[model samples]
Target: MGTIVVTGGTGTLGRHVTERLREAGREVRVVSRHSAPYAVDLRDGRGLDAALAGAGTVVHCATTPSGGDERAARRLIDAAGRAGVAHLVYISIVGVDRVPFGYYRTKLAVEGLVERSGLGWTILRTTQFHDLVLRVLQGAARLPLLLPVPAGVPDQPVEVREVAAHLAELALGEPAGRVPDMGGPEVRTLEDLAEAYLRASGRRRRVVRVPLVGASYRAFRAGGHLARDRAVGTGTFEDHLRRHFAPGARG
Candidate 1:
């Protein structure tokens, strides 16, 4: 098989995806701003074509919350199209179309670009990752006493490794447009997740619910980001917490 280029290969999701592909004995070229030899910034086309040259599949995982995902996708698509890449697999959030958040909107727009890129493509929409939920709670726990979390919002946090394995499988196969959604084993309220986080970290902070205002918040509260029927992931958030806080885990 030809080389598979993975963007953002140094990042959390991309790292696992790259590892999975390599374990499968595939030729994997990791392209990122920090990845040497094949370093390329998705924000612009600089060095992107060189990284994508002779690649059979390109897994677009690089993303930012500070905006500009659309531009990045455009550059990547242009480069992939020119390089004669066969399949373009993209990772996206489950509620991109329903959520009004800027990042989600950008992701949805990127999905549209991938669909129209004139190359075979696959899109996998997944729920929030366990690491993200834990990170948010960790940040909130920085408060002296009470840990405030969004009221009425629930999250289904999937394991990143599981997602990476699936993405690798998709990359090794033919393009399948818009596959089924993937979700965590269980869906719990934000407050419940915060409390669980506190318990897992041995913190004594009281979990407080703060009602957020906005269409995006409303969509989240209404479970627009959840995939109750698609609870395909086997790992729970607690499982992630255990591994995260295990001995030598932080290192």
Candidate 2:
């Protein structure tokens, strides 16, 4: 097989993916807008012609949070075809099709594109990441005195490294095409997550659970982004908090 190319190599998940691939002694090529040997503007499709050349498998971890998930997927798909890349692996959130959000809609569109890209493709619909959860908690902590959390909004926040390892393993194998979703070991509510953050960090703030009402929150409350049966990740929210908030933890 040729080199394994990793898109979005600068992002949290992509970094771990590249690390795992290199540890396995695989010839890895990293494609990113910056901070990688193979710099490629995935949106404009620039540099991809050279970045994907001789690539056996291309892991699609790149994302445009603001918008343009579909544009990037189309660009990469065309590039992969021209480069003769074999497999295309994508990282997606669970329940993208079931959720009624713009981002989820865009992701579902990309999933469709990958399915019909005529290449061996695998899309792993994992739950939210611990990093994102932490960021939300941190933002909530900025409240004057109370951290407001949406009640009944549950999440299965898996660690990035776990997802990255899974992606690397999938990249080495034949395309499985919409394999089982990956999720954290346990399901938790947003309130529980906020409480954990406060407990771990010893923050002097109250966690207020507010009732959720919007469509997005309704989907989250209904477990739209959960894979209850496929809790493949071992790490838990408490475990992640310990790393940063344990006694003598990082300052």
Candidate 3:
């Protein structure tokens, strides 16, 4: 295997993917605009070719949450094509095809690009991360009195480490077009997750279910972003929370 380049190697998910690849004894190179093994922005064509030098596979993990994900993805694909890279692995979110959100729209567009790029590719669509749920809980803590959750919406948050490991395995093998969708072991509601977190931390808080009124809400309530049949994570929300509050445990 030639050098495998991981774009966005410095990000939350990217870091885990990078570490997994390194542990497998693969020659891994991180591509980023900042302090990576190779300094290359996906949007910068000039730097991309240099970074792709001798790289047999490219894991396109870099993303822009705003709206430029498709443009960046296109640039990366073109560069990879020019450099004759063998495989391109893309990380995307579940229900990106059904969601009307801008970020998901961009991801869908990039998936289209990969399908037509003629290079071996694999797209892994995963559910929201456990960290995202924790972030929501932490942000709602400021309200002082209520834990607001979208009514009737369910989430199955996966561990970032599991997603990273799956990606690494894909990078090491022949491209398997659109691998099975991955999610946490259990299905849960937003309010229940929030309550679990509060209880684990010993914080007394009232949980409230607020009706979401938009396309995003509709999709979420319909479980559009979750993988019900293909759930594949080892850690549960409670397990993750216990580890988080372990050192600070007082009993």
Full-model lDDT for every candidate: 0.93, 0.89, 0.87
Candidate 2 Cα outliers beyond 4 Å, as residue runs:
246-251
Q: Which structure among the candidates has the greatest lDDT?
A: 1
Ranking by TM-score: 1, 2, 3
Off by over 4 Å in 1: none
Writing each residue's lDDT as its tens digit, candidate 2 over 1-251 gives: 89999998878899899999999999988888885567878788878888988998999999987987798899999999998999999999899988897899899999999999999899999988988999889998998899998887888889888999999999999989998999999898888889889888788788898896778878878888899999999999888888867677654
Best by TM-score: 1
- Name the candidate, 1 or 3, with the larger TM-score value: 1
What residue pairs clash in candidate 1, if any at all?
A: none
* TM-score of every model versus the real structure: 0.98, 0.95, 0.93
Q: Give the TM-score of candidate 1.
A: 0.98
Candidate 2 lDDT for residue 165: 92
Q: Judged by TM-score relative to the true structure, which candidate is superior, 1 or 2?
A: 1
Cα misplacement distance, residue 64 of candidate 2 (Å) = 2.2
Query: What would the per-residue lDDT of candidate 1 be over residues 25-131, giving only the tens digit for each residue?
Result: 99999999989998887887799988998999999999999988899999999999999999999999999999898889989999999999999999999999999
Question: In candidate 3, where is summed lDDT lowest over 10 consecutive residues?
Answer: 35-44
Model 3 agreement with the true structure over 56-140: per-residue lDDT tens digits: 9999889878666777888888888888899999999999988787788888889999989989999999998887888888888
